[model samples]
Target: MYVAVKGGEKAIDAAHAWLAERRRGAKEVPELSIAQIREQMTLAVNRVMAEGSLFDPDLAALAIKQARGDLIEAVFLIRAYRTTLPRFGYTLLVETAKMDCIRRISATFKDAPGGQVLGPTFDYTHRLLDFKLAAEGSLPDAPKAEPHIGPVPHITEFLNKEDLIQQEPANDKEPRDLTREPLDLPADRALRLQSLTRGDEGFVLGMAYSTQRGYGRNHAFVGELRIGTCAVEMEIPELGFAIEIGEVELTECETVNQFTGSKTEPPQFTRGYGLVFGQTERKAISMALVDRALRWKELGEENVGAPAQDEEFVLYHADNIQATGFLEHIKLPHYVDFQSELELVRKMRAEAMGTMQEAAE
Candidate 1:
């Protein structure tokens, strides 16, 4: 039996049709290709991949198109798709030291080991509007030398050799997966870093900015920032040896921050680490700063009630989906809620007026 269309159902159907028409735009205008988005909108795809924890460029591109260029929605779509896939054995720890680097630079040192490869950055370019680009113009490629191959040593290793920086102890413990398990309070460093990696970029950026603006100000120097491809390998149960699964582009950031020694400890520079899915230096750097701020308690420093230093605050508010869902839910019908509120206000006013009349009497 066919039922009559309700107000909401009819409205939803019309809205969907309108949205589809809007997504297409004018008939004369050429449609945006998935290839174009995959190539040109690389950053958006990267964010989706990073946040979704799925590294398929084609799928990300498709999601971006379906979402009408909303990267967060694309990320959510990818994440939903990812949840359906069967889990296999975990991969081996990537050897980042052997990364095929495209870009690597350090703010601390004049010249780094592999030398600074500017590689595909907008760092030196001026923010100018070019009318020619509006008509589909392109610029010539910048000059760059072939980067030094093999394992390029980290700059902090030099400082560590001289006891100038705090030593990061090697941990043999397996990291906890946030996706598989529920997030608990006072999370360990590994769990915290995982949350930050997939957290909303804007939220993390704001938290980091708050720290720099004196909310939890810890003087941070970029120890090193690198963008590169690293091989991901998985040990096959059938095979005796591990086989290379694939390569992924990654952005890694390490921040060296000022450390004040406790009564029993000696002074040494401390560090914060950030690793993300692609060419996202700003997010990576911000994550490191926020990570450092959150570690104040472990370092024996006073928790000055800063927003970044509060683990509960950062972890709870960082997920865009959680934030967006709650935000958008305000649009839902609230007739009952409003009616109750109106009744309460009217009753209060009546009581106040009665009291005033009694006083006058």
Candidate 2:
């Protein structure tokens, strides 16, 4: 066992005091407000919320500021704060079909039913940094339009009508909440999705990239990717009906994978789905690819022994908070453990040298 040496309660308190002072750098500069972080650093806030499994933008922003712009640390703070919250009734499943989309597109079809609406995106922008922004220069106002009046049906629906893609039968089973219970192996699709949606973006992205590099070989085509705000509804017992409580920005991706057929089944394309918080297209796309790779068994495909295909491996390591905690623990006091190892190594060395001397004699 490792034991603490010189560090004491006073030292810890002093360290924390220094940390708070360092978090707010320089008296001349204006301090970053929670509102500023929420408004300006929206993407970072969204990531923190998504990974933290909490949808409070304000809380995420505060965590970000308190953590001094460390997104993972912000996520950790948010997660810890989330545990203190009282459990309320669960919300109904969000209907993506009725999403008030700001950005929508389909790579597979040129003329998708909803038509491509390129809402605020960095896809077409040049990589060059704008020097004008260094001084916080203002710019012209972007044009706006009236909100669309109808539902934007999924692109997969059109393909499903032609029986070109596999159909997903509706399952109304209540998904298990991983937070409430300890994670068990052989997790269902719902549990897997829950873990993945809150998983580390970099880890998921890398795992997805591996599949593209012939690790799992799931050829994925972005059938549809849409970003918008969807209403969150919860059933009120007093009211006796579900009512919209709030709206949340979401990024949903549906990837059409390679066709699979067998002696017992007809040829049809498979699907991989991703639904994440905020305008995280890259993360959503990566999520879809990895989701497909993990579905090898369900899709009747042979196990490729890829890391992405291993559900246990992916789920276990995907949580950044857990991974970071385990990794960071190594930095803690290991003095006793180290001394024991040192003594053992020295004894072994002395014995080997004594034996060599006797042989020489």
Candidate 3:
């Protein structure tokens, strides 16, 4: 009796060992600590948290280290870990107005009620790399300041007073969670925004840039951009009062886009909003513009046939995890399919040769 060869167990173990060794690199070099990764490679951690929908910076850092600095893989790890977490209770809607904002700015007005605070941005920095960063260094501590600033108000409140922009309606209706439900056709604003927030940064940015290059261009202006930590509160059924569960850093962007008066409605400026789970201003701003562009239909605007306007096109290709997984899976074995195709081609060639011989005869 003949027996089939079996090496699956050994193969898997060897592959895992090899992967671990490679991830660790040369034994001579020191391993990267989670804290180091979190502090030094903050942007990568931010991306992972944003996409993974997990706000734990330390866990994100650990995922990055395990992934060997592959941001996408790190994101995947975080996402896998995030799925295992138990859901306690839903948080009460965070009030941004009460947010002790560290940074806030508005492009609509030169000077607004809440004065623009350009806090912690790389915008003004030169593109040139600082060579000093190549070596570990520390800077001297600066002087401390008093902490008694009054609560800052939103600049949009001023515009709302003038009736220039549409006032947002507050609804007590519960919004559907996209993560728990399969994405459906004709998604609402909340679902679309949720998808965009967790989407790949580059993909969203490219879509936004395309809009600027005359594809669904809505003439967006950065109406406001704010980054700060906000308290997440949850109401206890027994207590009958909301309590602060935790705090999460977020970046919120609101874009003011051109709006034309329809036959039924008066002309007024419209807005697109983006809120991300970390300090990701670029992604948030890009998302807001794309969100506005996608709203053309609801606003009674003509279909521009732009990439951003195509809901299916934008939503389907936005997630890097889904895209990369499908792309890389092509590398896996498909010997049976290839063998079938090979046999078909050989049979066709043989048939052609036979026909040619008969014709010659």
Candidate 4:
């Protein structure tokens, strides 16, 4: 006999309690502090911040812990928490040229004004797992250098002087916030870039890789990649001046792509840009390439029917939160729908059998 199951509330409560116990681990074990997570799991926190569109490491760390070390779930927690936060004001446009950089490099130039500082990177590291880190210990202190001698000017500014790249208008127009607004079709650069910054790293990487594998392959050179903290300033109407509310670490990437000129325009180099919260260079670089591929139409280049060129494809599938929610929602009750489909198929087959017998007779 089939009996309908009840006590869903009890079942849910039990599951939640089990989850809490699991997250905390045994009472004998030391409690995992938020500070410890923030310090030790910095890379995971960075990804959460980058995707969540928030910069608070501590909060991200807490979210990560609460989500049981699920990075995407941590990002979801941050995004949900961020919605309740009141917007005191918006930051003034951050001047990256004035960024106090920890790492800055350019592939287009041999030597730029800001001498390439290969600050903290894993580019040269061996992939072997460090067993030494299993035991708590400290390494020897490296020699420290004096503060940088002078201000580092942007390499792009040099190209801008000669007008080698397309000149962008410095309009003081206010841009729309992607979080508040529903994304519409034919998005402008501001919206596209904003969506991409919070996009899933793997998704962006795959789309960028597709472009490199001859799917709208526009020869791209990294114009600049920078990682550093920048002051977030907001203009107070009451004070009639901008104030430094806070600061956030950011990764910015700009790409110079080779583009064929159209009938109306002469041959010239074009640009693609990526900017994100925290030190996420890979995500930023991938975003820049994908951004360039999406701009084929605006640049008057031939549409190569690339996945990157498809704005709908890229923007819609980029966000992990949306993708995950829809993907996992299938776990919810669909028995009724399945039953209906099953009945329909059975009836269709029975009718087909009857029709076949009648035709044969």
lDDT of each: 0.87, 0.89, 0.84, 0.86
Tens-place lDDT per residue, model 2, 1-361, is 3444766999899999999999999989998899999998989998998899899899999999999999999999998998899998799989989999988989999999868888877899998999877887787677765445458999999998999998886888988998777678898888888888999999999999999999995899999999998999999999999999999999999999986686545788888988889888888999999988998877778887999999999999999999999999999988888888888988999999999999999
State the lDDT at 239 in candidate 2. 91
List residue ranges in candidate 3 displaced over 4 A. 1-7, 142-150, 351-361
Model 2, 139: alpha-carbon shift in Å? 1.3
lDDT by residue (tens digit), candidate 4, 1-361: 2233445888899999999999999899899899999998877899999999888999999999999999999999999999999987677788877777888889999777757878777887998898877776875688643323335677777888887887766767677899888788788888899999999999999999999889995688999998887778899899999888887888899898776678755677778889988788999999999999988777778887889999999999999999999999998877667777888888999999999999999
Q: What TM-score against the true fold does each predicted structure earn? A: 0.93, 0.96, 0.92, 0.94
- As for lDDT, the candidate ahead, 1 or 2, is 2
Q: Write the per-residue lDDT of candidate 3 for residues 37-75, one digit (tens) a residue.
A: 989887788889999888999999999999888889988
State model 3's lDDT: 0.84
Candidate 2 residue spans exceeding 4 A from truth: 1-4, 144-149
Sort by lDDT, best first: what order? 2, 1, 4, 3
lDDT of 2 at 88: 89
- Compare the candidates by lDDT and give the number of the best one: 2
lDDT of 1: 0.87
RMSD of each: 3.4, 1.9, 3.0, 2.1
Off by over 4 Å in 4: 1-7, 26-28, 144-151, 356-361
